[model samples]
Target: MIWNEHIECMDREQIEKLQSQRLCEMVERVYYNVPFYRKKMQVLGLEIGDIKGIEDLHKLPFTTKDDLRENYPFGMFAVPMSQVVRVHASSGTTGLPTVVGYTRNDLSNWSEIVARALYGAGVSKEDRIQNSYGYGLFTGGLGLHGGAEKVGATILPLSGGNTRKQIQSLVDFEPTAISCTPSYLLYLAETLKEEELLDKIKLRVAILGAEPWTENMRKEIEKQLNIKAIDIYGLSEIMGPGVSFECINQCGSHIAEDHFIPEIIDPKTLKPLPRGSEGELVFTTITKEALPLFRYRTKDLSSLIYETCECGRTSVRMTKITGRTDDMLIIRGVNVFPSQIESALLEIGETQPHYMIYVDRVNNLDTLEVWVEVDEKFFSDEIKQLEALTRKITKQIVNIIGISVKVKLVEPKTILRSEGKAKRVVDRRHI
Candidate 1:
């Protein structure tokens, strides 16, 4: 089932050797071709020869989103415009989107990794992949598209939205697999349920990412969709939706270590941490041509597994991302991630999966409220019964995050659903 056994099943020592060689070449590429990185190396008194291998990776400068934005549209591109083949960017909700470029070689490499991801997750030439990820500026749609094409599977380029059309295509094509955000798939599953068409279509595997999801959520998704849900990891900065993926074993996502060296680091100190330690994830692209990055801090929180997988891959795997440091909310001196709240809610199993967190400062103090949707059967219960369920949810969340949150129980299907990344948090506090 391995798409490229040569790289995926390589020995750990051999993988490290290859990474070192690629890292050195990548440093030289960035040092001379991009002045932004050259200035960073010079500031650290680093020369091209100083970086001999991946062992010297810690000695180099780290790249951040600000650095990418500071470079603006094309400042970070290592290759000239004539050589650049394509561009993809972030949503830029806060500022200018971090623009990523690709040469012909880079695009080919991107598609190769994505194809490996799809094939690793049980996709094959015999399968039909209905790509639900949006196409254009974003990387998810096209990233999976190329991967599906490389798999030689029939492609249904049904971009994000249009639930009716997605379900219709599902029924007509009987695609064996799908690719999209996990939250969107959940919404799609609900739609299928409403139409009583769950069993009519044939969907065996799901490739999901672009947002942090808990193990409980994954189980719920699999249960609801009647398909094996696999977690796929990638970011626009790190080559999009195929940076790594879970195999049939589903222990963790196997990283493409040969192309991008992965590291777990203490987010606070910006220092590398030991394997199995939960910390911020960082990556260094060694084979990228258009936009090569050195030690780019991803700000995602996860642990690394270095052992060989049952699927026979020696490449290191990263546990599912717990949360993003950037998405963390600090309330009354306590930091809380929405994923933690989500995990707590799902474990309770009393409320529906749909919920929202509202944070606001009132009367010189910060207030947190959780709007939980009561299960359909419980929504019409007596006030006392509803109050009891509310208390139960409140206690579970308080116990997990050490914060007192007012739990408000609402009716099922009351919360708005999204076909893209779910909007789980609404922070009204102005800081």
Candidate 2:
């Protein structure tokens, strides 16, 4: 079931050797071609020769989102604009967008890694894939499209939005696989149920990412849609949606270590953490030609597993992302993440996966309020019963997140649906 066994299932020592060689070459390329990287290395009194192998990766300065912003547009690109064949940019909600470039070889490699990801999800050429990720400046759509084509699978290039058309194509095309954000998939499932077309479609595997989702939510997706849900992790700064993926076994997502070296580091101290310790996930793209990044901090929180998987891939695996360090919210001296609230709500089983967290300062005290969408069945319940359910959810949140939260049980579909990454938090204190 493995694809590109030479790289995915290579011996651990051999894999490290390959990574070491690639790392050395990448460091040299950035040192000479990228002034930003060269200045950072020179400031540390380090040279290309100093980075001999993967062992010396720690010596290299970490690349942050702010660093990418400072460079802006094509400034971070290692190759000339003529050599770059493709460009993708982040939404840049905070400020200037981080732009990434890809050479011809980089695109091919991106396709290959995405192909490997599809294969790990039990996809085959016989299966038709519906790519629902956004297209254009976003990487998810084209990333999955190229990967599906690389795998020799038929592709339906139906990007995000157009819910009616998305469902129509699903039933008409009867695609066997789908790739999109998990929340969007849930919305699609709701649409299918509403239109009474769930049985008409033939979707088997869902490759979901672009947002951090909980396992409880996955089970709900599986139950509602009657399909196997697999998590795929990627960011636009890297190669896109094919960075890593979950196999059918679903133990952990196997990293494409040959192209991107994975590292877990303590976000606060910036020191490498031991394997299996939950910390910030970092990546260094050694195989990229147009834009080779050194120790790019992803801000995602996850642990790494180096043991061989039952699926027989020797590539290291990463646990499901818990949350982003930057996304963590401190309310009333308690650290909270939206994912924790999601996990708590989904664990309760009576509410839908759709929920929102609102944080504000009330009377100079930080307060947290959670708005949860309840199933239609719950809406018909007695008024007292609904109040009891709200109390129950409040207790669960307090127990799980160690903070008191006011729970509001709203009607289903009341929460705004997103075609891309879901907006789960609304911090009003800043306003």
Candidate 3:
């Protein structure tokens, strides 16, 4: 099936008209088939007719992760189990994993959206993609796998882990693109550098996702790995990593608005913010059938712009995520977010990506500690060199986080292993 290039290049008025039409159809379908939407509409004294267009979307109640949790398992599913061809769940970080189901049609639509995202990222049939995102239960691996297949790219389904083995596969398969967490890509670069085989690997593009990273880190990864680093944004609840992706311009990720509607709202007030205003990102799935979400608050903080992209895609664009509202760690009455520390760490230019923020209370005072993993070149048996490095990192952390931190320089592999999202904060404080 061919995508509408015209829709992708549509002007503001044209995109809005198309979105309004899709939103109206989505509302009607959900109201009729999904119990959750019916209940929400009834409580809001809303009828299907009331939601005439996209403007009336504000009249509908917003959905959230908590709401998905409240109706655990298949409560939010619009279709029966027999119709659901696939099921995936969140990581259950907050509570029980919220399950999402997809019908065959939904699966097909998902593939199409993902394919468009890849195309927007400059991936084509000639490209070879090595999908390092973990497969099974997790949607990133399979979601992108299907998209790669749809685009007719040779897919190397090397789903995460075994650094040496991954490198071997790259050596043999010679994939042009890779997709995984940015930190893991750095891990691969480190492994390649250790084996002195960095020059042997051939990769043109990288699609990094599932965590918030800075532009500085992007340049660092690109420089070390010798590939164009791009950010792909999505959550399992919102239909995996292909929801949006960065184009060659790298300004912001372009949302597949034809399938999913994007909105930026004030995190606290839940009011929609104007374009270019930074706020929490929200999504409303317009094409999903089994579990169509309406105004689902993603809680991720970022800005959105509707201007035409240099890549010629008319989809609304979102800036790189600054920090998640939930991921913000309150340390010593000062708000500390991982992205801030990430930016600071990248600015330092000496430390690697493997660093942990340790927060503990000492004598009724908050004590912050940063544990940074030392590279092989920096590893020293001499105590003076180690102490100097530690002191330098400690002072930098204090300057950035506004709290003096004890910097612990650990061995190369002393830090904890992160199979999924990297753990940023290790807080023992009881709040």
Candidate 4:
């Protein structure tokens, strides 16, 4: 089921060699065409000739989201405006949205890589894909749409929201595959159960991404939907949702090394870590034309697995993302991540996957509260049973994160559901 087997299964030595060649050319392009990159290289005393291969990647200046923001729209584009064919942007919730462009070839390459991702997820031309990711400026929807088209699979670009229509299409279209955020999938599962349409649809494989989720969450989705849930990783700053994907083996996601180079570095020291060391994930676009970023810090935390996969792809695999350095929450002098809270909740097996973390300052002291959605069966339990459940969750959080958290066991559907990426954290302290 491997797509583009030649590139996916290329020898490790050959892959590195190809990456070196592409990296050298990309560095040259950015150095000459983009003034921003030229100034960066000059400031670092770096020259195009000095960047000979992948080994010199560390010597180049790192590109951060701030760099993209400073450039704003079209400033970071290496190619002329006439050559650019498409544009996409980040949500820019904190500030100005980071903009990205794509040439005809860049779009084509994106499709090919996305196709590779679908192939890795065991999707093929025979499968009908239901893409629930939102379409407009967000990259997830169109990104998966184009890739599914490239794979010759029939696609129903349902976009996002409209739960009634989504369920109707799932049953009417009878799509064999689905793609969307994991949280959205949970909402869809809930709707399906409400309407008793779970058995009416024929979804076999799910490509979930755009948010960090735990293994317990994945198992829950699979169990509820009766399908295999595969993780697909990407960001708008990079190429979107197909930068890497998990194969059927589910060991780790195989990175598309021929196009982008992956690296893990200590967030504070900014020094590259050895293979299998968990740290910040960084990327360098080797073949990108419109926007070629060098050592772009993704801010995601994950390790790399270089051993050959049983699935037979030599490309390096990235372990499931644990959390983001930027997403880390510091409360009462304790660092915590929403994913940690999620893992603890799902492990207990009594609560649903939907939960929210609220951090606030009370009496000049930081306080953490977790709102968990209890399973329907537990909602009718005795008051003492609910109290005991709350105590159990509080103990688990204390044991795992070393911080006492107030656990509120809310009834099912109490917490709002998201059709796009789930909003799991609300830190009122920032406000």
Clashing pairs in 4: none
lDDT of each: 0.85, 0.86, 0.79, 0.86
- What's model 4's overall lDDT? 0.86
Query: 321-398, model 4: which lDDT tens digit per residue?
Result: 887777666454234667778878877878888999998765324579999998886675589888998999998877
Q: Which stretches of candidate 2 lie over 4 Å from their true place?
A: 328-431
Badly placed stretches (over 4 Å) of model 3 are: 1-4, 328-431
Q: lDDT: which candidate is best?
A: 2
> How well does each candidate superpose onto the true structure, as a TM-score?
0.78, 0.78, 0.76, 0.78
Model 1 lDDT, residue 149, Cα: 89
Q: Rank the candidates by lDDT, best first.
A: 2, 4, 1, 3
lDDT tens string, model 3, 172-285? 788889987776787788777888987787899898886666787688788998889988887777788778888878999988887788888998898998878999898988
Write candidate 1's Cα lDDT for 1-431 as tens digits: 99999999999889999999999888888888999989888988999999898889999899887788788889989988999989998733233557999989888988899889988998999999999988887788999998888889899999987888999999999999999877678778878888999999899999987766667768978898788999888988879888999998899999998889999999999999987899999999999999999889988888999999999988999998876767666564344667778877888886667899998766424689999887875565488877888888888888777668999877678898988989888987543
How far out, in Å, is residue 339 in model 4? Answer: 21
The local lDDT score (0 to 100) that residue 108 gets in candidate 4 is 95
Q: Which pairs of residues collide in candidate 2?
A: none
How far is 402's C-alpha from truth in model 3 (Å)?
32
Counted clashes in each candidate structure: 0, 0, 0, 0
